[model samples]
Target: MPQAVLDSPFGQMIMPALSRQIHANKRGGGILGIEQQTPGSSVKPQSQLHHPLAKVHVVSNLAQLDELLAKFQKSCAVIFFTSATCPPCKTLYPVYDDLAGEVGDKGVLIKVDTSQAFDVGSRFSISATPTFITFLKGQQENRWSGADPSALRGNVQLLVQMAWPPHPHQALNLPTFSNPNAEPVIFTKVPPLSKLLAKMGSTASDPAVQSIKTFIETRSSDGPAEATLPDIAAFTAIIRDSISTLPTDLLFTIVDLLRISLIDPRVSGYLAEEPSHRTVTAILAHVTGLPPKDCPYALRLVTLQMACNLFTSPLYPDQILGHPELRRLVTTLVSTSFLDGGHSSVRVAAASLLFNVALANSRRRRDGPGDVLPEEEQVELAASVLEAITQEEGSAEALEGMLLALGYLAYRMPLEGELADLLRAMEAGGLVLAKGRGLGGCDW
Candidate 1:
């Protein structure tokens, strides 16, 4: 009976659902003998257990009923259900048992056998067994003849609201900026975007992608010296939201943006919507404009193809060597960076460019057994690299790039004395020497 009462809110209509669960099992409805709860317990209902109803007495004999009602009158509610023979009537007893405190505040639930109290049922017009009629201050207020949990809760909410209204003037705890009156501002820690193909990474079949590809190819032939994108703030907004997700598609877009635009548009380190840059892919790119694709700007543009390798403009290697200006530019940037130690950011960018050019030179020298780089060309490449190391002298990033470039060269050029000495010098720089630093949180 207790199980039925507790579950009644969700399961009173179970008879119908039960028959549906197991086909043909749902013809008629009857009690499954759920456990009953005691009255005047902590298990009292949220509704009415605290209401002011009436109290009514139950007596099996007509003569005894008259005496009991006379003794307790003008009270809270009374709960009188059905006899043992009535299946549904048995379900209410457990409910009444656990929550009898209602007898004092709302009213009392009393059980009476319909067969035993036939004359009483006829007086109250009780047509069904276990019918519940709640009385308030000696007058009936509500009645429930069928079991419907949702319907029951609906009525309960209404009743509870009438008795107690929710807090009227309560305030919500919204975040308040320290400078609430400060000027309205949008954060600019996100990258710039080109409108030619927004959402390019997501819309796989979008028409914009084809249009942009065609535009790039056509422009490459003889369209414009620079394909300018609109200076729209919305593109910035798009990037701000995009980088926060740290989606790989967004990273691909970053790569594509570099490929399409010869210049590396500035990117902010954070988003306006978020307070942190924990997922940002490259801090150097955000702060110093040093993403892999942006390094060529520090070096002059070689031929379009070398420029592409240096990450200036997207061009294949074969096309770049054909241009004398680009070839001279690559040579000049590498030579000057080693000769003059200017800005650290520029130096870092310059070293990377040199590394790539060395690797390219080494590759060109290996095309055939009869081929060897001219002595002057080999000296230009070697001096360019050695100059970078000499200037950085001992910086970590510079040394690392030097080592990588040399290792790449050694693999291709089959090093002898001079190149071997450069390799030893770069190794002696010890770029990977920071392993014994603090174990605590980083300064960043």
Candidate 2:
């Protein structure tokens, strides 16, 4: 029942995004795919769940892994979901650690990058970091991959109850999907994790990341930049001096490399792994397009980290902020992050990225040679974030960050009372109620 998700790289890699969509499977075994929703499928949705929080690191060396696991095992339930370039893993991980905290005595939460534990992940049937296999009494249990937190909590509680029965309680129920007015709301679709979902059962050499290779070949400079280059030799070095320790998917590597590279830009132009800033933006454009994939959120977070590392070059973010694709993506992330999602953690993360992007856009506009666009667009970028904050007023995370952004912008540009008024209302006791209630909400 613990069949790993090797056959589906996109599914494996984007499981973090998809993890939130998981359904319970009681017919036994793991909750890996949408077979339950498949046409003519008789197997009812099972009772499996994805509640534990996991920490995943794609390591190529055992020494590093041992260092992490040693410390991790001593702390909590760590199910090491792993695989070679597990693409969907990040989608699932954002909450892996949170879920792990609930699995007391049920297991330890951990992950082993398949590249390092090829045999371990493979032997355990864990073909991806998005994989979930519980550990109890020093033994691993069945593997599952679903996005249902309640189901996961239920199952884990059951496991705990079986080991040490507690007073009987009611089972968790799934949320019902009801049509709201049928008012024709625009639906923003998340791009499929990748074009390789159907190819997971195929060989690892599948043409899943063909674009990645081309991307790297095109954007890659002649060599590394001397400035901010890091000692990520471990990340890029060859394993056993033979096989590439490098990830099979260029996007995965880019995401990871960017995270580390951002800390130091002296390694400038080395990461154009796709060609001009235009192409780099395009690649990430594909990523951000998948708002649910967390690519937009990931790009902004990565941007903040890498912004400092970029040499005096506009090519990178120029393509980014200028790209309608990325802009649209960020907008989607800011607005629907909570509206479209039920998770607070993800909403916070999404809002954080939105705030960063808006600030970056504001800063970029300020740096331009000439003033362009009416004062509206200038304030638009920042105002939208403020609007999101106003909507999310009750949320300390969203309100505080947004209020700060508004404060910073007001100080620099001199608000014409609108921004100032909202800022004051937020600071006063009414912001939270004013949030969803509208500026009209604080009409007092």
Candidate 3:
């Protein structure tokens, strides 16, 4: 017996008279002798298929469709026009649902049964029993008829690809992505060892300090195979124990020796990957606590460079970003030195360090769940950059670096709390105006 035709979004589905169109009622009235290939002429057996990627929302009314469209105005969309009486539509149901699930947040998938959603079907001229329409950024991109599973899968996958092309960072091989065990930065020109030792004077006499200097000199001339690095555990302990008793000048010189020794991956990598991170912590404390005015320009620059060189070990950044005190120390140093235009090199180095920090934060955000840096930390960093930009005394390179640092810190941050305040501060500093002045590549 034929099932009673009732309310359906598909409205009366018409089909060609054919015995092959089995499992369907005979009351189906449409143009006779029309080719079975003329759309809605074939129905394959249904099977269970899983859709784990995304959910296919059933749009019940025009209002629901409008809401979905507006909500995903900036996203990709796939709308499935289905019918109640169309067996071919039912056959393709599993394939369509699976495509939706696979696309996830990258694309919005919707299913509308025309028998129950005539208004939506009429809006898109969807008179056929089963049709699929894809939209990119709220605009209709492609539409096709019939319940061809392969075609449905291909077009939906293509829509997802168009919506989210691979991230630009994937193309960039950044320092943060380098092997943790890779070699450290080596100064191309070696300074005279005698002069360097003479400058250190009394501190050079310390066994641990002297050993570090010897290792750096030997490593530079003879290469990693020939030079033996100092016992890093002993060196770290000695520095920690001796720093308390040392004068500010001697402490600064010792830090410089540590900087030079960092040219060897053995030294820097050990310090970076230490279980307690005591080496980096001690170094940061000494460097940040140094009397700014009394510290020689050379010592200051080397210290900043040493901080930047920490990227040699991939684990170093993860440690730094996760520690509040360490993050504050780096950000404070970067903010202050970046504004010190009188020392262009210091300012630039500071900018570079900030860039690395920002980049690290961005990677953390993308790599997994969890906040890269605390919201308070991001706000503080943003404020520092905003103050520097307001002064506008730095070089273009410094400015560029500062902007990048701010950008990373603000990327994907919630628009509330200090982050919101930071945005307002940036506005007050003429960020919008500056964007209008040819710095157009950034997107909020």
Candidate 4:
């Protein structure tokens, strides 16, 4: 017998005639088990052990497979079909698992043992011991049968590429858009502690207020690591209780105190972890709810600065962006402050706050799958920034901050959404270009 014939599985069974019939059936598209390859196909046989870090879903039945497929319906998926006794199937296990780790949440990877999942085997007509199927957007895209690791990797990569094509913005020559400044623009200047505390009048005597004063003094002199945090619960209560009763002018004093202490991660983290974010929310709500004429300039300025300082804690950014009520109040305050014609400083501080919010949202998009700030809020913010950019004339610092914030918001944003439409409607690109000219050719 020929060596090819000797190496055939049928040779072991001593059933050459049966093997011939199977090959003929495969050529005629009747037998689904055998891999059909072109004469010059690049796929070659290869194998590997299962990868330790790979997160692969091993489904035992059709229901489990269905559930996984449904869960990742919009993403790419690869299903490996194999039997317990198949040696060739063992070879590609590691490659498949490694690919699962690489794909992560971008796609789904599944392995089904045909011996244990007879129903799954029948569902896909997986007759061969080691078969591979790829799905894109819930539809079957391709199928092959083999132990070829290279082929498996190529097909899966191609499916994922088709599922999530690169955004056109990614190809732009804008480096500023690509690399956002992760460091939030914060106001760290500490005014005289005695004078700042004296502004609080009778509240200055409260132990919570006094303790925070010491914490701020120590933090300013020795740095955050050396400073001990004051009682967060008592301080939060002080802010909550004072928001209602404190004279509007003196309210800025307490907020400034909170803002200074918030430079410490411990204080900011405590407020961030609060179930309702009640303390920060109360201050912002009370301040933003006031009519523009009634809201004190000192209070509003300190509030904006306080909002910017919240980003010092890694925990607060997500809460500020993720919590609906807080998100609304913060955005409202920033947007309202954007139109502050009298206080260019207030607008500058507001722009910094906006930049912090956009920076946080941009980081979320970069590190994860979806936008942390909802699309509607993004649209609202972009509109506010664009309006500020158009109206901005005197303060280049405020304009610079607004432009940076706008760039972060627009970076890697989906090109086919309401935001894209709004950008077009407002001719934001032209507005930015005009601002660039006025600013004597800004870098971004």
Q: Rate the local accuracy (lDDT) of all candidates.
A: 0.39, 0.38, 0.62, 0.78
By TM-score, who's the top model here? 4
Candidate 3 per-residue C-alpha lDDT over 123-208 given as tens digits, one digit per residue, 9 for 90 to 100: 88887878888888889899889877888898888887676654432333333222222232323334665676676657567787
Number of clashes in model 4? 2
The clash numbers for all candidates, in the given order, read 32, 52, 11, 2
User: Which candidate, 2 or 4, has the higher TM-score?
Assistant: 4
How displaced is residue 271 in candidate 4, in Å? 2.7
Task: List candidate 4 segments past 4 Å from native.
Answer: 1-71, 80-101, 110-132, 145-149, 440-444
Ranked candidates (TM-score, high to low): 4, 3, 2, 1
lDDT of 2 by residue, 1-444 (tens): 001211233224333532332232212211111111333433223234333343334455556545644643422234545554565665556555565555532334456676666666556665434656654433444567755556555655554444333211101111110111111111112223233323322222333233333222333433334232333333222211212232233234343333433333332345433343442344344543454445444344443333333322334444445545544544444443434234444445445544444444444323321122234333443434443553463466545545444432332232233333333322322433344243331111
TM-scores vs. true structure, each candidate? 0.28, 0.32, 0.54, 0.77
- Model 3 lDDT, full chain set: 0.62
Residues 343-419, candidate 4, lDDT per residue (tens digit)?
88999998999999988888766544457899888877776777778778889889888887887887767665656
Model 3 — TM-score against the truth?
Answer: 0.54
Q: Which candidate comes out best when scored by lDDT?
A: 4
Stretches of model 3 off by over 4 angstroms after superposition: 1-190, 290-296, 339-341, 415-417, 428-444
